[model samples]
Target: MTTVPRSLDEIIASADALADRFEAYEPADADRDSVDPTTALWLAASRRAAAERDLAAAVVEARRAGVPWKVVGELVGTSGEAARQRYGRHAAR
Candidate 1:
């Protein structure tokens, strides 16, 4: 069977689903099987890192397009100073 590639959001969602499943799981044979929580945690970390990178790239693009830090902050749901503090250096490059 051919497998389709999943987007970052989809991957994150799948990871969340797996976490929920694992959380509710009970092993019928404890000597034979186990559920690993680290997989979900790693997936969550990967998703967070990917999102941060994408946000930085968008910030750079917005700065290049002459978008104000205040506007960027509004779009990102933060104060202008906070947004600038977080992304100004990346946007500079």
Candidate 2:
């Protein structure tokens, strides 16, 4: 969609209005120490990574302990060959 560009006067007026609003703004309880979206996402990603690593370690243990890929596949909701294809290399380790 093409936007009609604002005139210089309109732009200045909008900027001045924003500046005035910013200058007049006061902090409320809701604005203090709220959850930051970026930080929250970073924390969630970190947790997900840690969980993935833990799952891999457990899979390696199961593989080494002679757990069949059929059992693993049932638990993980995939085919036995699929599970083997994904994690069979770790079996020797």
- Which candidate gets the maximum lDDT versus the true structure? 1
Clash count list over all predictions: 0, 0
Which RMSD does model 1 reach against the true structure? 13.1
Per-residue lDDT of model 1, residues 1-93, tens digit only: 834438988788878988999999876797345447897689789999999999999999999999999999999999989999999999999
User: TM-score of model 2 relative to the true fold?
Assistant: 0.57
Give each model's whole-structure lDDT: 0.90, 0.82
Backbone clash total for model 1 is: 0
- Clashing pairs for model 1 are none
Off by over 4 Å in 1: 1-35
- TM-scores for the candidates: 0.62, 0.57
Best by TM-score: 1
Residue-wise lDDT of candidate 2 within 6-91, one digit each (tens)? Answer: 99987887789889999999999987768799988998999999986877777889887888889988877898899888777766
